[model samples]
Target: MRPMNNAPLDTDRPNSLIIAPQWIGDAVMTEPLLRRLHARGERLTVGALPWVAPVYRAMPQVAEVIEFPFAHGGLQFRERRAIAKRVEGRFETAYVLPNSLKSALLPFLASIPRRVGYFGEARVGLLTHRLKNPKSKPPMVAFYSALSGESGFDADRPQLKFSDQDISAALARQGLPVSGYYVFAPGAEFGPAKRWPAKHFAELAASLDLPVLLLGSGKEAELCDEIVLLSNTANNAKCLSLAGKTSLTEALCLIAASRACISNDSGLMHVAAALGVRQVAIFGSSSPLHTPPLSDQASVLWLKNDASYQSPLDCAPCFERICPLGHTRCLNDISAQRVRDLL
Candidate 1:
């Protein structure tokens, strides 16, 4: 219950708002929507990540953040109900940004009178404002804007809002030398199709005269190691792998330190984009227009195919885990030389 400015709290209807975005990247991308809500006299309460609740909790714009115990698709019935009860009678309007069949259940059961979301996965009865998924919705920002009926969403890089305190705290924790270093996050949760070969990353790191900071989660430790060990760097100094070392908040601080970053289209890339770091974010499964990195300086490197190996596969950007075709030509075809040129 942070006291936002005293103003009328409704859209010619009623006020008090709570919104739950489907994922971390989407949550970051919806900063403009929160800003717009603030403009129209609405208090913001967000549902945050399952484990990394502290990151968004410290965010200035987020007055309240309740972390769901379940991961993205983990539907624990009792747990969801308890969370819903906690949220019940807390807000008059709840916005569900996810399009899944079950994304509406919690909000619906919570008894939030005005639930707003898109008409997807046959959840028509759940949403008060069932926005038609627009034909011209290229950027994901537009999708977030539609949540609160905000029109003409300017397609920019992802919109993430953080506080000076958050920035300060994050920076103080990571004491990395900032002299000419480029952060490289070459992992994607979208699975193997999105991952450019680890060896290629090593190749790219060798070419760079400056420091290359390798970043990812604990799950990506082995991959990061393979990249670091195999990479051929000139002098004695090696690429610093901070994959398992820092939390999400610490990573944010380190990402801000670098001159630029090269990442696969993943959460780290989204965060880098939000920080407005100069980025070269390569994309394969996810198209640039659909989910471009937030920074204007971010460039997406995609695979080009000729007669020999046409597209990643017939179902190239299928956006699935473990490529349907055994070989991941889309990412494999993108040579380290091509990435080197971008760097």
Candidate 2:
């Protein structure tokens, strides 16, 4: 965690503390909002969960990235208050990205005059300024950009920047040459409904001419190992599972330097898109309309929109962690050949 701004607030220039989302993809989606804030001469400091802190670090507009020592579920009132005390008068405003009531507590407890976010959960009183929550899901980029009190951002795209020298150093540590290998992120934090099968990923790896590196969090190590094992059995395909081995920073560097990236609708998919890498993003249970990769280099493969798919996926975009119908045809029907053909 980076040190807090203990040296009193600099009131000359406005500074805002951002309460970032826990999910990696959602953190990436918030970049456009940060950019807008910085453009207006606001010094930005992002308070992010440890897992998603690296995403904020990659954004040039962010002045500092403070990893919050908080966990999933519950309020953690004592923890929030303690951290809030340290940053009490540091920010003029606080942007609570997540809609949960607890996400707004720190800003409120710190006495930030302007606490902005969507009006959702029981956080109505926690936020000083709130926009009524939308009736339906909107594009994530546009959803986040609205916090800046700006309109006509429906067509905006989020972007991330990394130093070329830093990327080269990270790749050298991994013994990978730039653009020499392909990246495959097969794990979706959501659940199996969003994942492309291990066997399917192995088949795609086996068909590719270059080496494939499997990337994900420690929780997904076993899943990625399954892909590596399956690929090895198929004509000795070159597949390496570096899921738990590399840090998120290293993974971002790898994705930035890859020949191309292939992923399910996972966080790394958005990372690849923000880095402006050529990528083929596969969508299963989720709709591409709500959270499509906002990059020109991205090619999304969602069967929900395909006309030739047998018995169109009407049950798609269910957004469930697991398929309720027992059969995950939405993902199962998407073959390895189809994904490989896109690349």
Of the candidates shown, which would achieve the greatest lDDT relative to the real structure?
A: 2
Best by TM-score: 2
TM-score of each: 0.82, 0.96
Off by over 4 Å in 2: 5-8, 235-237
lDDT of 2: 0.91
Per-residue lDDT for 160-182 in model 2, tens only? 88899889998989898789999
RMSD, every candidate, angstroms: 4.5, 1.4
Clashing pairs in 2: none
Look at candidate 2 and tell me the lDDT of residue 17: 95
Query: Going through the candidates in order, what is the number of backbone clashes in each?
Result: 2, 0
The alpha-carbon root-mean-square deviation between model 2 and the true structure, to one decimal in Å, is 1.4
